[model samples]
Target chain A: MIETTQLTKRYGNLTAVDGISFKVEPGQVLGFLGPNGAGKSTTMKMIAGFLAPTSGGAKVCGYDVESQPIEAKRSLGYLPEGAPSYGEMTPRAFLEFIADVRGIAGDARKRRLDDVIGRLQLEGVLAQPIDTLSKGFKRRVGLAQAILHDPPVLILDEPTDGLDPNQKHEVRALINAMSHDKIIVISTHILEEVHAVCTRAVIIAGGKLLADATPAELETRSRYHGAVSLTATNTGEARAALARVADIESIEIDPQDHRITAFPKKGRAIFVAVSDALKAQNVTVSELALEAGRLDEVFRTITQPQIKGGRA
Target chain B: MNPIATVFRRELKGYFATPVAYVFIVIFLILAGSLTFYFGGFYERGQADLSAFFIYHPWLYLFLVPAIAMRLWAEERKSGTIELLLTLPITMFQAVLAKFLAAWAFVGIALALTFPIWITVNYLGDPDNGVIFTGYVGSFLMAGAFLAIGSCLSAATRNQVVAFILTVVACFLLLLAGFPLVLGFFQTILPQGVVDAISGLSLYAHFDAISKGVLDLRDIVYFVLTIGAWLYATAIVIDLKKAD
Candidate 1:
């Protein structure tokens, strides 16, 4: 298991990761969801033993990242932000160097190298210099290197940023397939990708985690209070009837279409009560359905834009 | 293979994989060879010795070695590859040693390519090959010294051009410390022992002794210790600047 206790990183006066704590169990795929500059990359780097946390601690397996860095790092495979690599070396050469450094030798090294080469499908450009390859190819090569040692824990930062649709699917499939054995934590700003490859997501904004749950649980949490759209024969009458239902926050009518929308505090109860109450008002209920909250909406709702004069 | 050896093998090949290595070797050889033969008056001395060749190596290396060593860490920092290399399981010392050896070996290759000059001297006269060998050894050690300084400077800056310029200036001053013009400037103001101590620290003075086949333990120790000291500083600088 991976655990952090009040882990924080401060640069001068600005806190990048502000006393946040979380955990990832074995065989779990955790998504680090955040907008740009949300401290996702900083937290990942700190966990990977690349950046020293300003306070508190992060532990990988059972080893402390700051004190037992070599041990912690040995069990972790990290693809740092931007996937930086040596431009002068070929993919094969770079991977070989990384394998050697990781102490994989002889047949084991070759076998693992072949496995990653095949998995990432880097055969065509294995011999090509990294500088000469396209961005997608370079990203694949970076991924191949990250998994070369098959470390038990994987921390990938924006792993599919440069991939095309087909390649993204393949990479997501690879991530899904590998999640059964490794503790994988992937950070990305793409909301759809969270559902695509993640089992649980930890969403952070303004350097503080706002939500942590299974994908389904998070979905439910965001939709707990949802908007319900209803069209009735008498729109104004339906609006008045729905407002009387328990937990119904507000109701608005569209004059042109004679349709009304209701935002309820308790989505499930209000949906039933509003539909029942509208019928009691002798209003023909044309449409009454609870809109499921999307990950995009949750991302926006939970992320409070930093305020300057309350404009945001 | 040992990890250091493995790193060395990869790094050694890294030099040949690009035009920078070849260009550096060719330019270094041409400049060193021309300076030794033309400016140092190799044939005019006509004493069946390699003093002329050995005398100019310090000045040549002041510029050429920095050109070779400027990219050792600076390029890694600029291209963001240092993150990849350093994050591996190896210690910083091993990485630093591997890269330093790769660059020094490239200089060694360029130095070796000047074998034709050795062959020419041998064919022309009964030159003392032992002295010539020692001179080559001194030259290589001095090259390492200059490279260590350049490597440290390279780690200090992200821009390769800035690294090159700073290394050149630092190395030029180290070389000129032994010149009469510089010593005379110091002689008027400083105590005689202080002037002597300053000049004694010059590469030309220690290298001059080694090139004459003296094999003084002190000179050998100075070069090795100088390389070690600067490389230790390089490691520290790397740690300080590494991204958080």
Candidate 2:
């Protein structure tokens, strides 16, 4: 388990992490969400024992991060921001160094090294210097090192920031495969990734926790949730007809495309009602679909600073 | 294995994994030989001794040893590997000690490779082997002193050039502490007791005493304490800069 108590970090007068606290149980993939400079990396650094907390502390497997860093670090595997490694060493040599540090020796070290290399597909470039590799390969090498020891707590920071789509898919699959019964925390500003692999997400803004909920729960807070949109031949008639539907909360019409969107009140399902109204009123509906929910909208509203006069 | 040994092995291997190690070794051997032959005139003196060679080590190491130590922490910081290193289950002391030992050992190798000089002196005449052995000890310890100073300054910056330059300047000042030029300046302004204390802190003075075959406990303590103090400062600098 990964637990934190009022974890705080400050740089001079500016607070980087402001009294943040949370507990992640086994079998959870917590996605840390934030905009640029929201202190996601700083918080990860504190829990990973790379930085001391100005006030408060974190623990990994009941070991205090500050007072018992070795114990805390021994139980955890951290992929620090930017996936830093010894650029001069080959991947094989680098993994050996990490394995040695973790006390994996002899036959076991060989097996573990081979397992991560195989899993990360590092065989082709095993002998290439890390600095000479591309961004995708470098990221995989970093991932290989983190999983080499098989520590129970895996903390990955922006694991797929600079990868192609295929590489991203592969990494996500890797995370999904290893997430069983492990407390995994991944930080990213990529919204789609949250739904892809994250079981839970915690949003931070201005060095403060803004929201914490499951991916589905957070999606429900989206304005597009349970909303129905239709492109009709007679836009005015369809827009007017949609108002007759039961529990219709709001309606927005696009003039150019003749698309009508209707939202339900109090989280009701509006699809059936909107469809029924379009059919019963003899409206010529060209297209109809329900959005999977606009998490991007919800993310923006919570992360962006609110204008005082409500203009933006 | 212990954490220090683990770090030591990796750091030593790190040196050879690049061309820098070969380059440093070549430069060190060439300079040490040339300085003794050309500047000290070892063959012209014909005294059947290596003091001509040993006398210039303090000056030679002031430039060479820091080149080895400059990249010790600076590269790690520049490449962000310091995070990976510090987050490992090793204490700061183990990491510092291991890295220092690796650099010291590398210098020791370069020093030992100058064995032809010892063999040459032995073959030419009956020189006091005991004095020669003490001189080698003094040279190794003095190299450690320079390395520790370099290691401490390297931790303060990520730029290797800056680390190298700062280490050279710092070592030069320490080497000059007991010289007439520096002592004259201090003597003219300061008291006698203060001057003596300052001279006692000069790396040249301790190394000179040991090189002369005195092997005083005070001189050994001086080098040991200086290395220990600098390494202690290295640990503190690393700890305080974790937030960076």
Candidate lDDT (C-alpha), each:
0.84, 0.89
In model 1, the clashing pairs are: none
TM-score of each: 0.90, 0.96
lDDT per residue (tens digit) for residues B92-186 in model 2: 89999999999999888889999998998899898999999999999999999999999999999888899999999999999999787899899
Model 1 residue A290 distance off true place after TM-score fit, in angstroms: 4.2
Candidate 1 global CA lDDT score? 0.84
The candidate that achieves the highest lDDT relative to the unseen native structure: 2
Q: Which residue ranges in model 2 land beyond 4 Å of their true spot? A: A233-237, A254-259, A284-287, A306-312
How well does candidate 2 score on lDDT at residue A287?
89
How many clashes does the backbone of model 2 have?
0
- How far residue A42's Cα lies from its native spot in candidate 2, in Å, is 0.6
Q: Could you give the DockQ of candidate 1? A: 0.60
Return the DockQ of model 2.
0.77
